[model samples]
Target chain A: MSEMTLVEAINLALARAMEDDPDVIVLGEDVGINGGVFRATAGLQTRFGSERVLDTPLAELLISGLCVGMAAQGLKPIGEIQFMGFLYPCIDQLVNHASRIRNRSQGRLTCPMVLRTPHGAGIRAPEHHSESTEAMLAHIPGLRVVIPSSPERAYGLLLAAIRDPDPVVFLEPTRIYRAAKGEVEDNGEALPLDVAFVLREGRDVTLISWGAMLKETMAAADALAVEGITAEVVDLATLKPYDEVTVLGSVAKTGRCVIVHEATRTGGFGAEIAALIAERSLTSLLAPVARITGYDTVIPMARLEQHMMPSVGRIVTAARKACQFS
Target chain B: MASKKMADGGLPVVARFEVRHRNYLAPDGSINRPLPAFASDANLLVSLYRAMVLLRSFDRKAVALQRTGRLGTYAVSLGQEAVSVGIASAMRSEDVLLPSYRDNGALLWRGVNPEEILLFWGGDERGNHFSGPVEDFPFCVPVGSQAPHAAGVGYAFKLRKEPRVAVCLFGDGATSKGDVYEAMNFAGVHKLPVVFVATNNQWAISVPLRLQTGCETLAQKAIAAGFIGEQVDGSDVVAVRAAAEEAVAAARDGQGPRFIEALAYRLGDHTTSDDASRYRQEAEVQARWREEPIARLRAFLVGQKMWSKAEEERLAAECHERVEAAVERYLATEPRRPETMFDHLYAELPEVYAAQRRELAGEGDV
Candidate 1:
């Protein structure tokens, strides 16, 4: 086991996957000689050779489309978009070809590709750099939307995403790429997808979050412990086809839920979790579900990005409301 | 005017280029140039003629079926048969084809049955499950998107060291899309084994070629991507096949990517949903009918004494019978079960979606 940042873990996972499977290829802008803008793919091209790690031209649509084609031809491709704000161009290829290739071809052709991009706010960056538009991607049917909150999850979940038989949009939280470090064994084991991880178990309330927001959610649980109120923390690793059993089970035990995210409140994924609780676990509820998320307006630039992101204080306040209710 | 000197002295000429057009058989059924070697095979020429006839027969029946409400809105390859048939005929069985909606003729030549084509137009997904040339891509509805797929396939072939080429077919209007340009640029940069065929059908629904772009010819678009681009008289199957064979062979031999722009006219409306008379003149359509691929090939075949009036009638009858049989098979196919929608969505359905599939099957409540 070695202490590694999230980005390093991602690099380690990629190297492990390529070493294991000759059919796996890594391609994106600046992924070859430059080792990617964030250095997530550092030293990959030199180690794996330029053929396995390719530097594509500056076109997101082509990158995604090439992956779909390559995947259809039996090559496992992991494509990267520099940032979430630039992911719009890929939506066309993802929706039209990648997602529905199997359905369209009636099992004749399948798209087993992964598109990775840095997601969410908190990074002091310019416009079109920090975006948490996971909701937009989750809305696409036939796509698996996954977000890893820590170095360990990032390493394990990325391997799982690459091995998945369908297309996956893997959103890596840029804010925590190097913010935290953890011991990640370089084992080639992949964590299961379409499931959630229960980080901290408690009885008073459930603090649900994923991606970079887990930092604040865990902190809120710690803060709530001081106030004599214990909060359960659940990390929804896979946003789409989420682990409803775990979420509903936690809600059933706690009887209260507080969902947090970095995306805007309107039509956010938090609403889906709230509705799930309302439909299945409403009878067990002690208080109405609450959602603490970004405002409906656009995420501001770095100067004001902190206000747009969910903080530990906000998560703790929401958990308090859920606990204090009748 | 005096020439300005550069910082390093005088500017040197960096590149020189030219575009060539091929036409062995003219629209008047006369030879415009020496025929390629393959034209000597009377049996091959006859087969090409038969394929064009079959495509036209299928196209006419498809339009009638759509009009009678038996089929959904369909894209017809009315006058562009030679372009598709020629390209597909040039490709080996191992080659991959990324075709557009109107390339049914190409698919048929590649061994896809007429019944499957009818099934596709009849709004069934099973049609895309091609039993023939299984590696070929299904019909791409979005314009120019398949170009990138072709490049990707070519890249895979190059990476695997496979001596195979990927052929992509699109329309004149698709040349304006950035996707096509980007794909071409990538293929050129990698020298991928890809051949891009642009069927310049002179119309993109209501828009004309003049309105699509200011370029004089679609073939010139390839020059910007650093490759050879040539035009062919699409009405003459001989020229299209010749150009395609050369390009496919060159790409397979690691000579880099090649582009072909086969100029044809959309002798019919864009699709069953379109009415060409609303945007184009009747006189233009009439003039194009004289240059349509099927009749031109038939006229040339008859002149060469390789075909006759009797053979023409017999081939037409055979095509009609074949098409009717396919229509019967298409009509006999039953609708798939509703729950099957979840079957192919993923290799194995996730447990979460199982409830919805069960609900769709009327087995459980969500």
Candidate 2:
């Protein structure tokens, strides 16, 4: 186990994936020579050569479309969209072409490719850099969405996503790249695409979160622990096929829930989890399902981003509100 | 159901005798011109003929399958089977074929297994694509989308200096799409080694010939895109083969891309979802049927003594038997698992989904 930041964890995971699978290729703007703007693919091209680590054209559609052929012809492509907002142009290929290829082929062709996009608002990045629109992706039936919190989880979950036999949208929380550090197990063995990881055990309110905001949830839980509150934290690694069993079981035990994310409260995944908890674990609940989330507004560029992201205070307030419920 | 005379409609009723582009007999089953099988062997001719017959059979079967709810809405290639097969015959073993959804006939000619074809007709992935030396592409359902892929692959060939050419087969309806124009423009500008074969059967779903374009002919559209263009009689296999051969020659000889339009007819329902009678007058269908490629070719072959009536009947019987056996084979195979839906979704599975997949696995195997 080695202590490292999320960015380091991602780089380690990529190194391992590239080492293990000759078919696995990394391609994006600046991903080859510059190791990507975020340095997520640092040393990858150097280690694997420029052929496997491609520096593609800036056109998103071509980047996405080229992967379809490459993957079809037996290459595992990992496409980096740079930011969550930049993924829009490639959505048509992902949603319309990649996701449905297997079904459209009546089970003949499978798009076993992975896409990584940096999501969420926190460090005052430019517009479209920190946006997270996972709900629209949630509506797609065939895609699997994954979001990891700490560097350790990023390495493990990313390895698993890369090995899964479907198209995976690996949503990286750029905000936590430097902030979240943990011991990473860089073993090439990947986990499943539908399991949720439990970060902490508690008998009080259940704290459900993913991506970068998971740090705030943990911080909030620790703060609450000083006040004699026990919180159960669940880090949702994969989003589309979310671990309902883990979440529902925790909700049934804790009997309270607070969903957290950097995305806006309106129509976020928080709403879905909240509704599910309210419907299933309502009888055992000690509080209404609360959510500590960002406001329903566009991600502001720098300077004003502090007002947009859900903070540790927000999670604590939501937890307190949940514990006070009759 | 057709009018006694062709003068009733605004369509030019070009007489077969005056139709200068003949390499086969007229509709009355008499040879009108000598067949130009210059570069082909007898084996290829028989293969092409057999393929054209299978195409007709498969189209009928797919239409029936769609009607019975066994398949999704399909695009049929009924009247233009000869052109599809003849053009496909021109492709070398290493050549790549890019075809629209309506080009099922071409798929058969290109050697996609009949059983696999049936699976595609039944909406199974096993039928979607066959991985083999044939190098044929899966049907392009989005109309003109495959043209760009053809150009891309062709560009790769040019880059690699491979002698192979990419044959892009689409329809007149697809010509109107922006992707088609863009792909052709790129292919021309880049001098990509691509042969653009337009099967101008003259309908964009329900749109008529006039609605397809005001250009005098579909081949003209290719001229504007900076490629040599030619219009040929799609019903005549000899003419289609000659045109395709010439176009492919241009692409192979570093002359870049060329467009060849095979003007033919679409003589069936678009798919099970379509009812042609609702749009076209009964007389129109009958009028189109009079120039059926198969009947004309059969007559021409008989006149030249190269083909026999007994041989034709025997070939039809063999085709029917082979198709039936393929269908039987598909029936024998077990139904695909439902989780195959998840197969190949990603190259790797995340740790988070293990438990859920376990649950799904425990529930029952699809």
Candidate 3:
């Protein structure tokens, strides 16, 4: 096991997947010689050769649509959308063609491609660069939206996403890309997907979060523990096919839940989890579910970004509110 | 006419480009150039004419079905039958076809059964699963989007060193979209085995070709992407087939991507829901009908003495019989259940979707 950052783990995953499968190709803007803007694909082009690692022109629509075609023609293409902001231009390809090809063809054709993009705000990226739009992508069917918060999870989940039979929108949180380091075993093992990971289990209340915001959520859990509050912290790795059983079971046992995310409060994935808890585990709830999320407005600029994003203090407050509810 | 380049001192001209147009058969059923060997064969020419006629019959029946409320809104190939048949007939069975919504004629000629095309436009998903050419894509309703997909397929072929080509068929308006330009650029840079066939049928829904771009011709657009682009008289099946055969052969031989702008006219409305009369003059439509592909091919066939009036009558009756049988089959099939909408949405429906699917069927616990 080697200690690596989230970005390094992602790079390792791509390298391992490429080494194992000759059909796996890496292509995107600046992904070849430049090693990607964030360097997530650093040294891949030289290691794997230009044939497998490609640096395409700055065309997101072509990049996304090309993967759909390649996937249908029996190539496992891993396409990168530089940032979550740049992904808008190619959403048509993902929504109209890539997502519908299998169903439209009645399983005659399937797009086994993985679209990777950095998401969420925290690195103080300019406008359109730091949007946390996983909820928007998760809304689409036939596309799995995954986010990895830690180095280990990033390595395993990215491998699983690449190997998934259907198209997967793997949203890498830019905030935690290199913010932390963890021991990652690059033994070519892929972790399970479509399930939530239980970080620190508690019985009083459940702190549900995923992606970058897992940082603040885990911190809040620690603070709550100092106050003698046992909080169950659940990390939702996959947003679309959410591990509802795990979340519902936690909420049922805890009888209180606080959902936190970096996206807007309105129509964020938090709302979906809240709704599910209310609908299924409502009777077991001793208190109302509280949501700690970004505002409805756009993710603000560098200075005000902190104000717009959900903070550790806010998560703690929401958790306290949930635990103290009548 | 030839274009001359002037020298500026010691500075040299960086690049030069020229667009070529091919027209083997004129509008009055006269030969413009020496016909290709395939065009010279009476049996091959008649088969090409027959395919175009069959598609025309299918188009007419589809429009009638939509008119009588028996089918959903349909896009008719109409005057552009030659473009589709030409490209389809020229393509080998192994070459994948990425067709737009209006390329029903091409799909039909590519061995997709008349019933399958009818079922697709008739609003059924099962029709997308064609019995022939398993690698071909379904009709892309969105404009200009399929080009990159074809490029990607071609990229795969090039990567595998396979002697296969991907044929992307679109309309004039698609050339205006950035996706088309990007696909062309990718194909050019990679030298992928792909052919982009833009059936420039003069209109993109309500927009005319003149409004689509200021580039003298849509064929010139490929030059900007660093590749060869050519134009062909789409009404002339011989020209279209010859151009497509050449282009497809070149791509399969690893000569990189080729772009062909086949000029035709949209004789029918964009769809049954659209009213072309609102946007264009009836005289223009009437004038375009004179250049319709089926009649043009038949005129050439008659001029060659290869197609007699009796043969025309027999072929027309046969086409009608085939179209009517497809219509009957489409009308007899049952619509998919509402709950089935959740099935194709994913390979295996997730638990949340499964609950929703059950809820749709009134069997949900939530």
State TM-scores per candidate. Answer: 0.98, 0.76, 0.97
Clashing pairs in 1: none
Each candidate's interface RMSD (Å, one decimal) is 0.8, 4.5, 1.0
Tell me the tens digit of each residue's lDDT in model 1 across A1-326. Answer: 99999999999999999999999999999999899998988999999999889999999999998998899889999999999999998888988999899988999999999999999888898899999989888888889999998899999999999999999999999999999689999999999999999999999999999999999999999999999999999999999889999999999999999999989999999999999999999999999999999999899998999998888999999889888899
**Tens digits of per-residue lDDT for model 3, B204-267:** 8898887888878899899988888999999999999999999999999888999999999998
Could you give candidate 1's per-residue lDDT for residues B68-138 as a string of tens digits? 99999999888899999999999999999999999999999999999998898899889999766888999
TM-score (second chain) of model 1: 0.96
Stretches of model 3 off by over 4 angstroms after superposition: B1-12, B361-366
**A234-305: candidate 2 lDDT, tens digit per residue:** 987778878888999999999889999888878898898887777667887888888888888777778989
Predicted complexes: DockQ each: 0.83, 0.16, 0.84
Question: lDDT ranking from best to worst?
Answer: 1, 3, 2
- Clash-forming residue pairs, model 3: none
Q: Relative to the true structure, how large is the alpha-carbon lDDT of every model?
A: 0.93, 0.77, 0.90
Tell me the lDDT of model 1 at A80.
93
Question: B16-61, model 2: which lDDT tens digit per residue?
Answer: 2211233554666564566565623655666666788887887777
DockQ value of candidate 2: 0.16
